[model samples]
Target: MIESWRWYGPFDKITLPEIAQTGATGIVTALHEIPYGEVWPSALVASRNGEIRAAGFDWVVVESLPIHERIKRGEGDLSELFANYRQSMANLAANGVKTICYNFMPLLDWTRTDLTAPVARGGSCLRFEAAKMAAFEIHMLGRAEAEADYTPEALQMAAIWFQKASETDRDALLHAIMSGLPGAFDRYDIAGLRQALKGYEGIGRADLRANYQRFLDEVVPAAEDLGMALCVHPDDPPRDILGLPRIVSSGADITWVLNAVDSPANGLTFCTGSLGANPTNDLPALARQFADRVHFAHLRNVRKDPDGSFEEAAHLEGDTDMAAVIAALLDEQKRTGRIIPFRPDHGHELLWDAEKGTHPGYPLIGRLRGLAELRGVIAGLRHRD
Candidate 1:
């Protein structure tokens, strides 16, 4: 693996020099300051790339180039939006970044009911509790079709849970669920959020996948021409929340993406943690099947609970067979003779590190432990080979 770290941008407390100390040579970053659906100017791209190089890291991958809601809805100025995305790919390419990781979930990029669930290891970590989520959907946000998404047992639990939420808890849950989006949850009021969710109103997974294919058809050519790989990120939480469709949550999803554009330029960011949230996702097996297209990876795990429940786990200790995941990744590298870019993603906030106020899981000590674990696995695999 070409071990890497995800850098949030210039304002991030975790500096690139600090990232270099972690031993990762590649930087997985994005032009977050730029607005969505607009072209990323070559100048802005060069500035960030130059900074990473100056700090002793390679601008190797982009964590994302967000697809606008307008394009997802196949609504307003979608042609122009897609064209801008294509041009953004071109700009990122001009700066020598080769891979782009993006997702297709509507409205929310990812959803978690509890941003600070107390973990067994002690410090607070992100979690998704079905009960809290249901309360948000039914009582707080009042999303239509909320009850139908759950089983009778979950609905019953949610009904009781909703009754007990303090007004503050309910509001907090709403903010957390709608926390991060294209413009970073800037439009999260119930009515607007509902409208955004409804924009996919009649749209199903199949419909969304088709739209994604069309979007790719418009831009993958640009990626190919620029010698860039577009690695689509899997859905975080990996489940349909609030009755919304999730197209990037499964092996089949990756297959669909590959079939959309049969080229090395079209690839996958095999995030074990995101896909592992679904008990059905066989991480090792999926890794083996999609190895060729996996140009980027997020190595993390989640310990799943009953009724849409889960909390982030240590990178090596989560429910995912992280050993097998790493083994597969290393095997892929040996087979291809090329190191794939990987970042130990979404770590728990830990002691001493909590005082810094870093981006969710981008803390130093937590990910240092994770990277060490993953590095050990990689070394073991190599020695055996």
Candidate 2:
């Protein structure tokens, strides 16, 4: 596995020089400045690649080249959006960046109820509490059909949570969930969220799956031709939320997605943190089963609760058997002699991380610690061989 770090382009609080000192040679990033559904010109792609190279690191993967909502919803004529996406892939390939990681989660990218849930270790980690999420959807967002999505027990819990939550708590929950949308701070509100949810009114699991297949049919071939791999990231939390369908959240779903467009370019971004949120995922087994099709990996772990609450755990300490997963990936690399680029994802905010005020789950020291721990695991595993 090639070690990589996700950098949110020029504006990221963690600079390239600081990243270079982390011992990672590969950079996983995207041209976040460009709006979704826009073509990334070859020159701009080349410039970004040059910027990484100048910092003594290789841009190994495009963390995402976002899919337009129109494309995801299978809405009206998306020929232009499809064209833009293909062009972006071509541009990225032209600049020698071949692996692309993206997700098809509706409305929100990755939902969490708390961005700074304190842990026993005195550090903070991202968390998702089921009742709180239910509270937000039921009492806060006031989605009419939200109650139908939860069980009677869950509804009661949510009601209690909503009743007990103060104005500040409610506001924080709203911010945490809404902030998952890109540029949400500027445009997101209760009305905006309701409007967004309205778009998916008639769409369900099958509809979203069909839309994803349509997207693959359109762009996978282009990616293959460009010698690129388009890897779809697993839905964060790996479950239904906001009454929206999450198609890419399990082994069966991943198998269906890979089979939709049978090509090396049509692949999976094996995200442990996301997949591990679901207790039944069996991370090591899934890693072994999908090893050949995995183009990138988000190596992190999570502590899951029976009630669907979860928090980002230390890279190696959660329910996921990190060593076993890494071992499977290592075996795949050995079998095919192909390198899988992976990054330590969603690290806890520790040391000076809280003070730096970096993006949630993206503090410098926290990720550095995760990387070091993961690197040590890899080394120890290899030493046994």
Model 1 scores what on Cα lDDT? 0.82
Residue-wise lDDT of candidate 2 within 1-385, one digit each (tens)? 8999998887588999999999999999888878889898999899989999999999999977899888889999999999999998988888899999999998788889999999897889999988888888889888768777767777889999888989998888888876555431234678888888788889999999999999999999998789999899999878888889999889999999999999999999999999999888999999999999999999999999888889999998999999999999999999999999999999999988998877778889889999999999999999988
Clashing pairs in 1: 198-201
Evaluate residue 311 in candidate 1 and report its C-alpha lDDT on the 0 to 100 scale: 81
The ten-residue window of minimal lDDT in model 1 covers 178-187
Q: Show pairs that collide, candidate 2.
A: none
TM-score of each: 0.96, 0.97
**lDDT per model, in order?**
0.82, 0.89
- Residue 114 displacement (Å), model 2: 0.3
Residues 1-385 of candidate 1 have per-residue lDDT tens digits of 7889888886578887788889988888888877788899999999999988989889888977988877777775577887889888888887788789988877677778777677775777878888777767887668757877777787777878888878787777776776545334245777877766767788788878778888889988888899989888899878787677888888887788899889998889899888999888899999989988899989998999877688889988889988888788788888879889898987888787788887665678788878888888888878888
Assess candidate 1 and give its TM-score to the true structure: 0.96
